[model samples]
Target: MFSNLAIDVALGLIFIYLLYSLLASIVQELIARLFNARARVLTKGLRRMLEDDDHSGDLGFFGRFTFFNFFYELGWSVVYFFQPFKNSPFLKQFYQSPAIRYLGENSAAARPAYISPAIFSQTMVHLLRGPHKDNQLSDADAIRECLAQNSLQLSADTLAHIRDLFEDARHDITAFRLLLEAWFNETMTRASGWYRKHTQAWLLILGMGIAAAFNVDSIAIARILMKDKSVREQMVQLAMSRQPQYAAITDTLIRKNVLHRDSAFFRTDTTWKVMVRDTSLIGVYGMLRNDLGDAKNVLGISRACVTDTTATGLPVVRCGFTHPYQRNGWLIAAGWAMTALAISLGAPFWFDLLGKVVKFRSAPPPNTTVTGE
Candidate 1:
């Protein structure tokens, strides 16, 4: 009985964490989009790679301050915005070049989230070669001449490095571009790692914030689930309802049926019927309402605060100071830490774990037979 109850409690807790981790990821994606985070990170990586400037890696004395960290990221976006006009540097020229410029929108602030290494190599070769006639210097020789003059503002080490790559390519222009592409690809792999680390850090912070805000105390929720059979069953049912989202070969219509479509099904019993139509103006409001309803149901945190209907047919809701979180500060903190750690494991981890746990919980107990042995 204890073992069975333990499985049920675990199922409930895992379901809640899965929901909030997904929520954290969605918020993180929104923030990334708003800040153009990928482009900013790519730009920083490129600046480091080509310009050979270590100064860009840190924000100086201000960078040492934790409070100013966000301002520094915001500053990167600002720099990305003004990058086109700052053509004094070779990095700026590379960004503004015809081939590179078209990758992003015409707007000054628009930055491409990705640039192929092939394009990078080709653009660098063309920019460095300049407009020398075929009879004059060969493309490779022109590039070598530019490096010797240091006209591209390349650091001495960077210049030396390119010269070595040029020599390694036997002074062949095409071969040199191939070598450059390989170099860029290697550097980009490291850049991708940095971006992933940044994302995980953001996820941790968002997870803790969401856990605290919703009073999603995993310990408290687990205790409730273990003690209350009805609550445990309800949580399991919710988990089952959500499982269809992970279906790999499910048909589009079947997938649609598995998830609620509030706009299409508003006040309708049939899937094909629509009772109320929402316009563009009210769509955002509807989405927010739906999201809030989902949050209340999935997190099981809505029970902390009660809403009672008054005698005059009005609703009264009490929150904040009256909430249980105020009373169990230490427990709430511990729960938040646990929740944040779980959420940091990412939604895919929880989703896969939830599936396995649900299967285990539902599996029939092994039969024990004592025969004449």
Candidate 2:
């Protein structure tokens, strides 16, 4: 039902999205490494569950300013800008407690990215039991007593909720522990949602940045592919030739091994541990430089300078910061926005779509039997 030219153009666009999405993923991984994103997300979720104030709006004098006050009211305020985590005493203590204190690489500073439900139960039980010289009260009874006395400074709603869970468990310490684990697991599902939402925001920002840097205007690219028969043919050939390589990259086993330093490349069985050790941006880009070079060949995108002969037959081009955006600024911006949105959908999505499109193009047309309806 579709023309060959249309299919080829679609292939070229999908390939572009696939390449840029992979690049954006690498950048996102680097950012996650630098910020300990997983660990922070876990801690944030725990703080919210514990009803601990993370100093989200503890902005002292600045909190009086209309601008800061506006953000505070909008629920987009920050924590620890002026005052430290003074408002998060319980959370600070929980992290510093014996059960959790040594779980991370930097025991004194970093928090663990993952905390099993069992470990969470253990930590909660230990914190609830508190310090008693005699240790007279059993774990469940101690937690109940603490809640009754408001020793932990927990909110009335949290206190009532835990008390109900305890009652539902029939005050049996084992059952209470199980119930606690179940509750923690349920809360973590929401935590994962929080992480996903923030990650998408970061991906969008990275997509826009990469699209602008590379002049990957999707609209302009589609126009070029539609009008230039030679370029379309070349792009189709390029896509067909590189299909196996892209497939390998997208394979589940290979993707899982990407960040493992000692993992060997499955295709060549070669080691890349040495290459991964260099954390510099140049070193990181070097790992994917070959694919990037191929992507640069996609038509309608330009880098560096272009030369042309004037009416006098003299070269009138200088090699400076020449880019395709110098002309048709609005069109180029629109293209960049479109490309960015596609890239944000991610590498796997585009690659899978590319395979389907390629298959449809190659498959024989549906049977056209002349049977009467």
Candidate 3:
């Protein structure tokens, strides 16, 4: 019975960590947008590909100019649109093709907009080969002159490669276009890695903040849950009853709310209203509300575990402090650190752990027959 209770306590902690990680992710997304980290990395890559001098630090113009910003937003939009389909093999192959993926057969004339290395290469090639006096220039010369005019810098090796490709495919625009696409794809892949690294870093920072804000002392909570049989039983029962509901809500949240659209960008009133109405954001909101409603009960348990009586016989609260640096100090700090680390592991990790625990609990005990019977 004690062993089963321990498992329940562990599952309850996993559920809390999952909730914390989800909140952290939402906060991290907002922080990413506020910093425009994705856009900055993308624009930096574009500048490197276009420019002549690698020393030039003039990316202010990209932010200032509407033309550059438009392309930046368009590129990110493409990344955002395909995010949900990242796990789908067919969609992944479709994204790499030159042909645009249309919404449906009925919308044949209207193609869903997206950007890729191929698209980038084609656009730049058209820009360089535009109808004007510059059209008379050779492809290599035109590309060089365009880079010079824009004050964009490319590494000597990159420039040499581009020039060689241009010369080799001087008459074959298709072959040159393919080479350019390959180069851009490689560079963009690296940029994507950079974006992901920054995002993880932001999540860690947010996790620590959330741990402190909620006073999520894992060590203290575990001790309390282990000693208090009544509270442990209540928590176990609540977890068992709510696990299915939580799973359903989480599925809806991921499929319909979190991954359906880019959370970083602002939306129109009509779109925002529709999202609010249909998305699982409301489900998350309700979950949080319910958790907050239970906060007092949780606090009561904490107080019962840690409270003391003064000489006057008045009860003094000793456990719940937002900062871990007071009272039991180092021990409390360790608990906070444990919570922050767990949160950094992310929501999916905790959710998977919870699922396994639930599965184990649901499994039947080994069959046994009494010989005396």
On lDDT, the candidate that comes out on top is 2
List the pairs of residues colliding in candidate 3.
Answer: 51-152, 51-153, 51-154, 52-152, 52-153, 53-153
Worst 10 residues of 3 by lDDT: 265-274
| Candidate 3 residue lDDT tens string, 1-373 | 2237679779767867777777776666555444444444554454445443122224465677767766775665466444523323322333333343332122322322224565566665655454346438876566656545532233454556666767677646777888787777677666666555556666678877876776777887787677778767676666667677767755554443332222222112212222223234555666755863463265242322467899999998775554223358687778788888887776656766878887887776557344673
After superposition, which runs of candidate 1 have C-alpha atoms over 4 Å from their true positions?
1-3, 56-88, 106-109, 247-300, 303-326, 362-373
Q: Write model 1 residue lDDT over 32-100, tens digit each, in one string.
A: 656667667777777767775533348777777766777776675576556623422767777778877
- What's model 3's lDDT at 340? 86
> What are the Cα lDDT values of the candidates?
0.66, 0.69, 0.57
> lDDT by residue for model 2 over 72-127, one digit each (tens)?
73463245322223456667778888777676657433576667787877787788
Estimated TM-score for each candidate: 0.72, 0.76, 0.61
lDDT value, candidate 2, whole model: 0.69
Please say which candidate is ahead in lDDT: 2 or 3: 2
lDDT of 3: 0.57
Which stretches in model 2 have alpha-carbon errors above 4 Å?
A: 1-3, 52-70, 73-77, 80-86, 107-109, 131-135, 251-287, 303-326, 368-373
